[model samples]
Target: MDFSIILMIIGIVCVVVSFFLKDSSKKIEKDLEELSISIYQETNSLKRRLKVVEEELLLEPNFQVKSPLPNKTKSSINQSFQLKQTEAAPAKNVKPINEILVRQVIELKKQGYTLQEMIKMSPLSEEQIRYILTNNGGIQ
Candidate 1:
């Protein structure tokens, strides 16, 4: 074959290969875009779940409900006290701290155990120990 004919054949082969590669590259690009979208959606879902968990953790267990009645008769006072106790009971149930663990925390506080020492001794977190102590008239 002539050199020019050989060169023409090689150029044609190159063009054919480029066409095949172009199609495959387009498929790969589409797959990558789909993967990116899936990852983004998963990240958003995880963030939403984390936000809900944070809100639950930050909720106070000992919030008091004020009475609607302004009058202060002895009977009314007793009724109000009972109402307050009932309302507080439900709030306590919302965040179910272990009674045994709470008593342990209080006892440790009474024994003058430091916060860091209590954290090391107990299974509960620092925040949990602090909350128990503060609510039970222990040190801040």
Candidate 2:
């Protein structure tokens, strides 16, 4: 019932409370580490998906326009269209665009060449030229 005894009792209670707090802090730290690891894995997965989507976009199929005929039979027109498509099958083989070509497209855009002119000068399609210009910050 002295002041020193009261202080000793208070110190013992503080030590007991700190032991419990230490366990809770360890649990909190473990949870934070797990959350960070999950976030890192999800970020890597998203990056991989984005890369696949970009590759798919770059490998777009080729489409050709056909002019309307004034007076052609349906069967004959179908046959002719099928034949033309078969003949042009090789044209559908799209090649991957290289960095050099992308840079050239960017340079062409900077030199004030029209989109159509760029398409004619380069082997790339109009869409590819536009994509290069837009992605490379060449578009005004």
Candidate 3:
């Protein structure tokens, strides 16, 4: 009779422990879901803030975002920064070489120029001319 009582007690303890564990597991899952949602929202907020800062940077004319080393002299920094500014300025005015070359290649292709002739007249390589012709729905 004492043995039977001990078995019943063990069974009751197991059932109570299982219910407690199940409830705690559900609470843990709810907390994790809340944390995941919070992180996703924060990430999107950071992305929006970054886009605003980038737009502001682009709008400012004299704001040079320099990446000079901490130990660099001011004169050296000025020289390097000026060089970058000058190089970046001209890029806005000139058309890309590829766009110009593609137009020239299209004209040459229309004129029945051979591949070798097109390659000789333009700075583009033979492969580049062929690629442009093939991809632009021009002659083979």
| RMSD (Å) per prediction | 12.0, 10.8, 14.9
Clashes of each: 0, 0, 0
Reference-based lDDT, each prediction = 0.64, 0.64, 0.64
- The residue-by-residue lDDT of candidate 1 on 1-140, one tens digit each, is 69999999999999998877758777999999999999999999999999987665446433233433232332343354446556757554224344445566888888989999999998776766765666554322
Which 10 residues in a row give candidate 2 its minimum summed lDDT?
A: 62-71
Worst 10 contiguous positions by lDDT, candidate 3: 65-74
TM-scores, each model vs. reference = 0.44, 0.43, 0.36
Q: After TM-score superposition, what is the CA distance of residue 40 in candidate 2 from its true location, in Å? A: 0.9
What is the Cα-based lDDT of residue 13 in candidate 2?
Answer: 100
Clashes of 1: 0
lDDT of each residue in 1-140, candidate 3, tens digit only:
99999999999999988876757777999999999999999999999999999887555433433423232332343344445445767454322223435566878889989899998999865655665676553422
Judged by lDDT against the true structure, how good is candidate 2? 0.64
- Residue pairs with backbone overlap in model 3: none
Model 1: which residue pairs collide? Answer: none
In angstroms, the error of model 1 at 18 is 3.5
lDDT of 2 by residue, 5-75 (tens): 99999999999988777577779999999999999999999999999977765555321223232223323
